[model samples]
Target: MSVDREPGLRERKKERTRRAISDVAMRLFADRGFDNVTVAEVAEAAEVSLSTVFNYFPTKEDIFFDRQEDVEQEWGEVVRGRKPGESAVAALRRHYFEALERREPRSGIAEGLVTFHRMIEESPALRAREREIGERGVEALARTLAEEAGADPDDITPRVVANQVAGVYGALYNEGRRRLLAGQSVEEAYPFLLRAARRAFDLLENGVGDYCIRPG
Candidate 1:
């Protein structure tokens, strides 16, 4: 069957090749460990050349985190695209809940992700890579917040806000993963996740010793 999914045939072929390689790599990594598989093995198994693998994935970790850059961009956009007059904290809070409603894998609420999470847990290198990704997300959010406030490039407030937001996200994400991996279904998980997230964001909005006051 002649295909018309994307604009061009060449693009379709490229997508097929990328998916094929990714499927092979993930299967091998899941069968073996992430640290044990080399790019050459992945290429060979996928019937691609080593250079082709490097073309798509600069490192083996890149294969695991194929969407990391897109995710970082989304974090910045979440702050930048917040509704007019919305505080950064409010925008992030709304985004967090929306991700839950959509069952986003990044939110750690989606099913079928525990195996992938387990893979990361089993690899020291992947754990370090995940930390690096978190730091990058914080930096991107900080840059957007600084832009919004027209702050000096050296200002610490944006960085502080970014750290606070990132810390909240990291804690919530890990806790959610713990619950989900422990066999709680999405229906059983989100109520507690929402409650905990609300309290966490409340802490950010109204500092310690103060009640949360919704913005006018």
Candidate 2:
């Protein structure tokens, strides 16, 4: 009989410490402001040393964007595990709607208070960091698409598809943020995002099909 090796106590403890530090940092940023919160204060509140906090998160911005890695992983999974008959655009559209149904915050349709949404929009650093994350996500998605299509990494088709898919998410995220800042509840924002996603993907599916069949 083979015994499955679970994570050791030390590893679990380290993960707990990491979460504690990140949670404290987010709470502080939400209460005061992202720009004003200091790493030392977060370390003290989380009962970890400053070095430990840095060990978990290399920089202050990392704590605020802890879930960025998760988003990239999900995007890769969608492309790599798409159904046999599904196009890349179809796979991404399905993933987005599934996230919406689950009320995932990364979908940008989850219930968050208006203040938090406004605070993110008002911070230039956060906005810039978010754009960087967006680019990373697009690149990851493109790599997965290239694998699925048996194309080179630098091929234009994968890049174009990734741009379209990422553009849909970007538009949805901004619309959700705009509506939340305008005092719309998550319930009110959900349908609008869903409709927008459908329209965006429809345009891509039609446009791509036409382009692929066009004569040289």
Candidate 3:
């Protein structure tokens, strides 16, 4: 999953080529627009053949989401690898805060992320694909939770929990992105995001049964 530790000449070259291609593709996409460019153009601009591009990325969207699988596994891995006595919500909370502390790009709260965000918003295809990826993430988390809880195949609790957890995270992430795209710098938004994240995760961990009442 990590290429930083990779050794040998061939592996290093392939990594460089992949990075070059991805970088070129993003730059082109950001400059003109995602829909305005084509893979062939990107290949020509990057000086790699179309086949070479395909060898690294399967689709145009793959060019944008170069680490799709890694990103998907990230949340599930946090839950799956949670320490003893750590709830899934707590594990995810810890993972998210770690990203916020480092301002990791995956958190979508990092600086310059709005450029890519704007591109995705402009492209319906990318928007649909991102939504699909979100659903896949939810399913992956649900499966992991089910396995951890030793739930019966017919049980829907894990799946339900997954949806709720994913929804909470999606909301928190969108809120962070909103603040950033509103022209707030990372330094300004991150503190507020951390507070928002803590509150959202707290609701998940503590339950929402009494969150709101009619006050009758």
Best candidate, lDDT-wise?
1
Which residue runs does candidate 1 get wrong by more than 4 Å?
1-12, 207-216
What local lDDT score does residue 53 receive in model 1, on the 0 to 100 scale?
93
lDDT for model 3, please. Answer: 0.82
What lDDT tens digits, residue by residue, belong to model 1 across residues 6-86? 468788888888878888999999989999999999999999999999988899998998788987777778877777667
- Per-candidate TM-score against the hidden true structure: 0.87, 0.89, 0.88
Residue 202 of candidate 2: its Cα lDDT?
88
Q: With candidate 1 superimposed using the best TM-score fit, by how many Å does residue 40's alpha carbon deviate from the native?
A: 1.7
RMSD of each: 4.2, 3.9, 6.4
Candidate with better TM-score, 1 vs 2: 2
lDDT of 2 by residue, 105-142 (tens): 76776765465666577778888888888899988877
Off by over 4 Å in 2: 1-7, 113-116, 209-216
lDDT order of candidates, top first: 1, 3, 2
Pairs that collide in candidate 3 are none
